[model samples]
Target: MKPLLELRRVFFRYGKRSPYILSGVNLKIIRGKVYCIVGENGSGKTTLLHIMAGLLEPEKGEVLLDGKPLKEQLPRARRLIGILFQNPETMLFNPTVYDEIAYAPRQLFDEGETRKRVLESARLLGIEDLLERPTTSLSYGEKKVVALASIISYDPEIILLDEPLSNLHPERKRRVLNMIRSLAAKGKAVVITSPDLELLDNICDVTLTLSEGRLKEGG
Candidate 1:
C-alpha cells in the first residue's frame, strides 16, 4: 500500500554556513499505526516534524503527501495534517479555551457545527469544564490539553505530536496514550517524538532513533 505521507532523502540546515540538522532522512507514514521518534535534546526531532508538517522547507529532498510533493500541495496537505508543537503555549492564541479549540473548525464549519466540534474535542480530552476559562490563566498542563483539543477538533488524517507527554501528569498522560490508541484504531496515522524512549513504551508500533542527523530503525 502507498504511504499517506513520505519523506525522501530530506536534508535541512538553518543557514548556508550552518551544519545540517537533518540529513538523508527518509520515512513513510501509513494509516493506523503509531510511530515514535526517540532522540536526545537538539537532535533535530522537532525540525523533522516541522518539515513533515510543511511548516519548514528542507534545503534538500522532498516531502510528499498522497504521492504529491508537499510544496505543490501545501494547502491540501495542511488540511490533512495536525501538529502539536513541543510548547503548548506556542499553539494556543485565542482568548478563551473554546475559541482556541474552535479556531480551525470555525473556518470550515458554520456556527452550530463549529460548536459541536469544539465541544466534542473538549469532551474527549476531559476539558469541557475549562471551555469558559481564559487561556492565559490556564496552567501548563491545561494548556497542553487545550492545544490537543484544538487539533482534534479538526480531525486531521495525520497527527504529529512533539514531546506530547512532557509536563503531563500520570492521569493526563494515560488519557493521551489512550487517545493515541483510539486514533490509530480508527485508521489515523500518529507520530510522536520524545527525547526519552521510556516515555514511548507500549504505544509505538515502530520506534526509531534520530542521531547524527539521520533516522535509524530501533531506539
Candidate 2:
C-alpha cells in the first residue's frame, strides 16, 4: 500500500545563504504505526513535521500525500493531518476550553456534531471538567491537554505531536502516551518528537534519530 505521507530527499533552510536544516531527509508515514523522532534542539524535527503538515515547502525535495504532491493535495492533506506545536501555548487562542476544542469542528460540523466532537475529545484527554475554564487560566500541562483535544476533535488521519511529554505530570504523561497508542491502534499515523528517548519507550513502533540534517533508524 502507498504510504500515507512521504518526504523524498527533502531540503530546507531559513534563508538563501543559511546552512540547510534538513538535507535530503526522507520519511514514510504509514497508518497504524507510531513514529518517534528523537533529536537535539536544532536538529530540524519541527521543520520536518511542518513540511509533512504542508506548513512549509521544502527547498529541494518534495512531500507527497497518498502519492500526490502535498502542494497539489493541500485541501485533502489539511483534512488528513493535525500538528501540535512544541509550545502548547502557540496552539491555544480561544476563550474557554470548549471553544478551543470546538474551533475546528465548528468549521465543518453542525452545532450538535460540534458539541459532540468537543466533549468527546475533552473526555479522551480526561479534561471534561476543564471545558468551562478559560484557556488562559489553565496550567501548562492542562493547556497542552486542551491543545491536544483541539486537534483530536477533528479526527485527522495523521497526528504530529512535538515534545508532547514535556511539562506534563507523570500521570498526564502516561495519559498522553496511552492516547498516542490508542490513536495508532485506530489506524492514525502518529508522529512524536522528543529530545529524550527514554520518555518514548514502549510506545513507538519505530524510533528515528535526527542529527546533522539526516534521519536514521534507532534513537
Candidate 3:
C-alpha cells in the first residue's frame, strides 16, 4: 500500500529571527498504525505536523500525501489529514457543542450525512450529552473532547493529534486513548505527538523520539 504521508528533507522556521524548528525531517507513515512522536517541549513535532497538515509551507523539501506534493494537492491532503491542535480553541467558535462538531462536515458533505456524521462522532467521543451546551461553559477536558470530535466529523484518513492527553484527568485520558485505539483499529493512520512516553508506549504501534529537528524511529 502507498504510504499515507511522506516528508522528505523538510525544514521550517517560524520567522526570520527565530531558529529553525524542523530541519531535515523525513518519514513515511502507513495506514492502520498508531505512531507516537515524543521529545522535550521544544522539539519539532508540532511544526512537522503543521507542515503535513498544509497549515504552513516548508521553506525547504516537500510533504507529499499519496504521491502528490502537499502544496499542489491540498484538497486531497485535507481530505486525508485531520489535525486536532494542542489548543482546543483553534477548533471552537460556535455557541453549542453540536454546531461545533457538525461545522466542518457541513462544509463538504450533504445535510443528512452531516447530521449522521456529527451525531456518530459526538457519541463516540461521549459528548452527546453536552451537544447543546456552550463551548465556554465546558471544562478543559470537555473542550478537548469536542475538538477531537470535530476532527472525527471530518473523517480524515489520517489523524494528527497534538497532545490529546494534556491537562486531562487519568480517567479522561484513558477514554481518549481508547477512542484513538478504536480509530487505528478501523485502519486509520494516527500520528500522535506528545512528551508522554508511557501513554504512547502503551497504546501506540511505534514510538520515536524527536530531537533537534530529526525524528529517530523507535527511540
Highest TM-score, which number? 1
TM-score of 3: 0.95
Candidate 3 stretches with Cα past 4 Å from truth are: none
Model 3 score (lDDT): 0.87
Q: How many residue pairs clash in each candidate?
A: 0, 0, 0
lDDT of 1 by residue, 46-121 (tens): 9999999999999999899999899998776687999999999889899999999999999888999999999999
Q: Give per-model CA RMSD.
A: 0.7, 0.9, 1.4
lDDT of 3 by residue, 1-219 (tens): 888888999988889888889888888889999999999898988887888899999999988888878799866558778998988976789988988988888888999999999899987877789999999898888999999998989889999999999988887787788889999999999999998787554888888899988888885
lDDT of 2 at 32: 97
Worst window of 10 by summed lDDT in candidate 2 = 72-81
Against the true structure, what is each candidate's TM-score?
0.98, 0.98, 0.95
| lDDT score, candidate 1, position 130 | 98
lDDT of 2 by residue, 51-143 (tens): 989999999998988888999987756878999998988899999999999998898899999999998898888999999999999999999
User: How much lDDT does each candidate structure score?
Assistant: 0.94, 0.92, 0.87
